[model samples]
Target: MTGPTELPVPDTVDVRSGPEVSDQLLSLLPLLGEWHGEGVMTGTAAGSAQDVRFGQWMRFSHDGRGFLAYESRTWRLTDEGRIVGPDVRETGFWRPRGDDDVELLTASPEGLVEIYVGRARTTTSWELTSDVVARTPDAADVTRAVRLYGLVEGALMYAIDRAGADDPLRPTMSARLERLR
Candidate 1:
């Protein structure tokens, strides 16, 4: 896995106000708060059930350029709340394109560089597709993932798709998460 790198500074002149960021980006802001949900990760090798809690916070600033600077920290709960996974920190930039689109660039140790194209679907919902690529030597063995984000009833819902194996067929795992404030 890779670690964070110092991002190249941008060249610019504006600090405040163009068109307020896209609704798609705004819709994701609420997710900045704490979120607790149960996640089940199952694979061909083994499976386990455990309580999962994730916390996140995001801040947007200006780097003198037209881009909105963004950074966030995520924490995973473990050991009856006594332990936590390595704090997953994500730093990136967001920029609103035309009237309905926004672009997000991010990197993580998972050896992934992601470019997310977000489109507003409605007043309370939006959709985003991430183009992800692995940067490691064993990248060929990794599969691509497509994620869908939407609100069901009043809860946040997510779905993922991965390249399926050619061998014996089996159902893929999918999950739904409700906001627990």
Candidate 2:
């Protein structure tokens, strides 16, 4: 005759908190809208004097989780007005990491692994540094890049500084973006 049976309990228990989202991530709602910008990229296979027209659009969405997913598409044109080989698309996630920092995780087909830390500078400005890792060995890579985004003269302006390169005088890219709203 069976006297008694014991049920074993699992080691871990799942807890639900009805979508715990961060306030910092919610502040990025304004960036969700459409943005148009024109810029030029130099230091390609061509010489430094070559110019290209650039246009980019960034969008943000949520997937019922605490993280906000973002995608950015950019196109480059030749100096003679010819389309480049392919458009660049970067897919990533933005989420609050700690008290005063945000984390950005992204992956690209060009063997780019990116992780950025965001810090708020002012009410409408922020600074970010992306740690980039290359999947290939021969790529001229940068360990990290410091980027500042702010409004100057009613136009969106950005500056980038790349560090951890083999060369100290490596060329950097800088552009000013006018908000085409």
Candidate 3:
């Protein structure tokens, strides 16, 4: 005898037809989808010495649970709009506490793991400050970070500010992505 191959409780991008989303996650309802867009990346992070254009795809999905699984992948784009190669990739989860607080846990390919806690500023906006920025022995000297995500008009907009060993917090990346479906 064999069991089903499909996930017992699969994550769903289509909220209307997915396992009834828990009311606990309703505060984050607007962010349920896959988004793709281009954004500018600039900083002192090695390859980011100059302003670089990057394309990003982010998904926020739930599996009939209280948290939403998240993933983001970005690729570098030449000024001429050519895809050079991959840039940064990360995956994590978003959990809402009660009615207003939120927690985001993410792990990056660069050996960094972040735990951010914040709250819903409005029905369409959230601001998070890192409670911890842990990294492996070879990771960048990231000390702390903050991120803000919002829905403007019909687009998903986000920005991240980070501080390293001797670096002050500054804008690292910001983007506006459109829902694919």
* Strongest candidate by lDDT: 3
Candidate 1 yields a Cα-based lDDT of 0.48
Off by over 4 Å in 1: 1-52, 62-66, 138-143, 148-181
Backbone clash pairs for candidate 1 read: none
lDDT of 2 by residue, 67-169 (tens): 6776767777676656675555678886766554667787666666678788756645668787554545643365766666666775566655555466443
User: 23-72 in candidate 1: lDDT tens per residue?
Assistant: 44443443322233433233431133543444444345554444556554
For model 3, residues 1-181, the per-residue Cα lDDT tens digits are 9888887667898887769899999889899999999998875653556888889999999988899899999998999989999998999999999789999999998999999999999999999999999999999889999999999999999998899989999888899999996
TM-score of every candidate: 0.51, 0.65, 0.94
Query: Any runs in candidate 2 off by more than 4 Å, and if so which?
Result: 1-24, 44-51, 80-82, 131-134, 151-157, 169-171, 174-181
TM-score winner between 1 and 3, please give it.
3
Question: What lDDT does each candidate get?
Answer: 0.48, 0.57, 0.91
- Candidate order by TM-score, highest to lowest? 3, 2, 1
After aligning candidate 1 to the native by TM-score, how far in Å is the CA of 36 from where it should be?
10
Candidate RMSDs in Å, in order, are: 7.5, 11.1, 2.1
Between the candidate structures 1 and 2, which one is better when assessed by lDDT? Answer: 2
Candidate 3: worst-modelled 10 consecutive residues by lDDT: 40-49
